[model samples]
Target: MKKFNYQELVDSEQALQKRSIFWDPAIYEEELKQIFNRCWLFLGHESQLPQPGDFIRTYMGEDDVIVVRGKDKVIRAFLNACTHRGNKVCQAEGGNTRSFTCSYHGWSFNTEGELAGVPLEKEIYDNLPRERFGLVPVARLDSYKGLLFGCFSESAPSLIDYLGDIAWYIDVVTDSAQGGLEVVGAPYKTEIPGNWKLPVENAIGDGYHVAWAHAGAMSVVGAIGNGRSDNVLGINANNTGVDQSGAIEIVMNTHTVLTTLDGQSGYALYDHPEPVLAHLERNRPNVIEKLGELRGRQLYGSETHIGVFPNVQIIQGLNFIRIIHPKGPGKFEVWTYAMCERGMPDATKEIIHDHVRQTFGPAGLLEGDDGDFVEAITHSAAGYATRQMQGFLGMGMGRKAPWDGPGEASPGLVNEACQRGFYNQWRRTMEADNAYGVIGQTAPVTPVTAVLKEFRHG
Candidate 1:
């Protein structure tokens, strides 16, 4: 096993990332231990297991975990491995079950992960104590605005502290809803032939690719091509006054009426369409007020997007949360959840779901475009010369500054703020000795933010 000098590889501000970080098995192993084990990773949402006996199986890196709602109504998570002879405890993805039975042996565990039964305990090992062999539970678990996260390291900071300033951004979207956001259903799971970090980095705020990489999709949607839509090059452009290249506006107006939509707020509004409005109208004014008219309109009519760090990417306008799980240095398993508000009308939900399926799922058009680029980039790094060459992230390097506005804004769709912010944070996390150190560092800008600020006050 190759040991890496974590500090040397990641501490400097301008140092380019070593290509081996993406393709080396030994480095990946260290990431699993140093990063995944210590940092709070997003588990499935609370809605996935709302009732007792309901459970969903998910991954924390490569380790399998069962997220369950206990009889006490509290949520809990446990390793899927059976304590008796080490067999997998659950085979299916998610469902309501009284107990999980290990197929190899008849050992059973309840919703709370307590060892409930052992088939023929008297016959096996002269009656081994059931209390001594319950399923292993994760060290820490917490939720922020309905999104649950877990960590194998007990010393990790609370989920709120870990989220830090990013929580403010998340709240702009999640808390915008009256009842808060919920996952639509099970994730649309699939695999991609690229490193896991590629997709995560892309969605962390890579707006530069939307016009070029997803040009075909944009053209089909009746919007002008990103570059052709407007004759602006690099970061600065018109529209919102943020750097043009870094900001790609999706559905800013409803029938020519301009309305800016925040990611989570848009989700709540869209999830509950006309039918939900009627339902609310029948109730009371307070209920209707909770679902504000403009917010509701934006929800049903606007877009949703997210900048969740490390590995989750959500596009509310696109209606999916893409989770990238690293299978190996060169392989990734991409899981997408087609989400909407819980009480949304069936017709509206279906429309959003179908739209998401067509745009970003396993066989979707836009997904195909991005997958090609990710794989090609990973492959190109194989050449010694190519690996030595530094990739460009200076599209709007020193451009952004603090904005005194309702939300962070930027200009064009080609800025590098998002990608830069992601890498900056990634470098910090990888270099830190623990999660606390990672969260304590200064806030970094996504490429869009950097460029917009630069132009505003450069």
Candidate 2:
């Protein structure tokens, strides 16, 4: 069912992709089989369900899933459908419940995904086989920090190995605050008229779009003296972009990181930033003590954007996380979460939640700008002539990053090297024969010590 050359869909060397990928149903089907089925997919944060019997309904490549905390306090996930007659189960988005009862027939399942009861087992069914009727379970479940993920393949690499070098960059944010990060409120959700891949590509490393696409949002943000520029948000005293002398774009086998060695704007866009700044200042010594000045100062509060393969994105400075879920070939849903330090003051948490909605939430100014553009780009591919056209992501092509970080680095934040890395990873998964082929393609993890080079961008 392939309509074009698979090799040309994403050419690593040329840093280009065919426009058909955005509009083709056949390609989207292949993505479901190869990418979503094989890789670990983000579920929700552990903080969302702290006690036994708690559960949330989510998706794993269009497959409805129920992620629950068992009586043993272990997190588990299973297909969100009753075994008998294959009826839908657990319709509520999320809540604390001892068991899920199917609407069609009163079939119930325990938090451990075991069959609990049936409407008429003794009279109607006459000794029905209960052991074989438990919910189908996800093969692998793991956590990185507080984030939960479920993978369908048993043979896929461990979550740590899967994250590769990008893990080190994330450590800067997670390790700095002893209390760790948490999801502040329910995610702001909206549907976008675009390919699922579009926003993932945008969030991961499109530093080039900050100044141009987000001109309106940035203008307002800058007016109050917090001029955010560069890959992540950074304050510029002169109202110029963050200095790039120390910035680096690190592209690994299957992940990308855009770091501008001077991050510091975790909550800069908030109207009252005094408390946030004061909080960060109070933690400065501990951050320096634990991570050292290099990581503590540059990557901690500094703005950094991380793009994990397949479909997860983490953008600090804006201080939020989002997942691009594919609805089909023509549309996808964006689920945005406001993230914050766990031990933060209640007032600060309030600020973080509202700030997230104001900037990157579904109706957020910055996100609104991106939604229209990606939609325009995806819809244009529907035209036969346009679908046959090609696109380029060749900015800063062939340039190596000038840093001692984990992966090979590109020179600046505006470079498209990170975007190229994503496409290349996408191509590898789409071309693979099975889950192992995609999971085994990563390079050996670079030792964290070796990644920390004592070089400044300037």
Candidate 3:
């Protein structure tokens, strides 16, 4: 068990994170206690368990948990451990079950986590106290736009507050369709030999990799134009009709953005793009009136991606939310849910699902490229002395300021502001005594109900 100076390992904003944090057993234990045990970890989606008796087994750090829809149709979460002897009660990943029976001793618990039956209880000790032996429930459970989360710390703030400004961005993509979103299928789980934070940092807006790391995939997809030659586009490219607004228009009122491929704002290269365009052409005036010109162009067209911090990552055009769960320091489990509007045509849904499978899933062409980089960085940190050096995140560091952008405050895709914001929030949460401190901070909080209420309502 390699011990680490947590403060020194994390606070060196100028340098690389200490390599020990990835492979050190002692640091992993502390993270299990400080980070995983205290933060609002994404479990699954409400769509996964739409009816009573529906349950899914998940993990917070390494602890097994069961998120279930109770008989009342409300969602609840509990530790998967049996109270009698501390053995894991549920072994399967997810399913519909009326009661969970422990294989070791035949102890059974209902959806509400009440101990329903205990084998040989009367003979064992004149009836052991069943009331005192139910599965231990998690401290807090909540949802945002159908996404579920759980926290072990009793003092943690509401999930809404914890998400802060990121919620606004989430609503844009989530609320694009009329009836909201639904996940297509179970997640595709895999393990990457890397530090958990590396992926999070990457996904939290490491757009710089889109060109070089995924050059082959991008070229194949024809998403890049003249920008293909340079790994990163300079300010010159920003003005050549590829600025954020020209490339993607943010609907400030709605929080969704109108995305275009290489600044081409039309429906040309889509699979069924012709039919969808004809439909839009038939209803152009009304569609334009409702969605506005830019957003209307985005409707049934173009690839738009967004993230709901900590866990959910959605590409609207791709129609999937990749739920990331950190297994330990150097391992992670990714669950991707294919999202689509309820009542979407079967064909449309099928197309969306296939697109997600091709682009982002475990065997996805795009994900394959990024996964290698994530693993290489993790392994490189294995050198004790080399890991002590720094990795530069100062790209566009001092340039970012508060702004009304389509997304959160950022210096676009080329900057590290988003990664910095994620780690900043992460450090705050891990260092706080209780969850309230993490959610209660007085900074540039986002405009979600939880954050607004925490600072203004409270």
Best by lDDT: 2
Q: Give the TM-score of candidate 3.
A: 0.80
Please, what is the whole-model Cα lDDT of each candidate in the order they appear?
0.63, 0.79, 0.63
Instruction: State which candidate has the highest TM-score.
Output: 2
On lDDT, who's better, 1 or 2? 2
Pick the winner on TM-score between candidates 1 and 3: 3
> Order the candidates by TM-score, highest first — what do you get?
2, 3, 1
lDDT per residue (tens digit) for residues 115-222 in model 1 = 998877777567677788899998789988688898886655677777665564455346544465678668888777777778876765565675567666655531
Q: TM-score for every candidate vs. truth?
A: 0.79, 0.90, 0.80
What would you estimate as the lDDT of candidate 3?
Answer: 0.63
Task: Give lDDT tens digits, candidate 3, residues 1-458.
Answer: 22445466666366235555666666767667666776788887788898899999888877889999999898999999999888888998888999999999999999999999987777887757778988898878998888788988655667777766556546544554545568755788878877777776676456566666776665554224323332222222223322333233221211223234331223221334334344335544554465455445433344444544455566655566776677766778777777766655666566667666777778776788877877777777677776776566666565533444344344345566556555555555556554565654544444576554433411
lDDT of 2 at 54: 85
lDDT of 2 by residue, 1-458 (tens): 44446787887777779998999999999888788887889898888888999888888888889999999999999999889888888988888999999999889999998899988688898678889999999878999887788888665678887887888887776777558888754677898889998889888888777767887776666334354333334324333565456677888868888877764555555656667677787887888898777777777776678787888778776778888889998888888888888888988778767778888876787778998889998999999999988889999888775665688988777778888888888888887654555754643354555224201100
Clashing pairs in 3: 15-390, 15-391, 16-390, 16-391, 161-450, 165-446
**What TM-score would you give candidate 1 relative to the actual structure?**
0.79
lDDT (Cα) of model 1: 0.63
For model 1, the superposed segments whose C-alpha errors exceed 4 Å read 1-12, 222-304, 405-412, 441-458
Give the 10-residue window scoring lowest on summed lDDT in candidate 1: 250-259
> How far off is residue 31 in model 2, in Å?
0.1
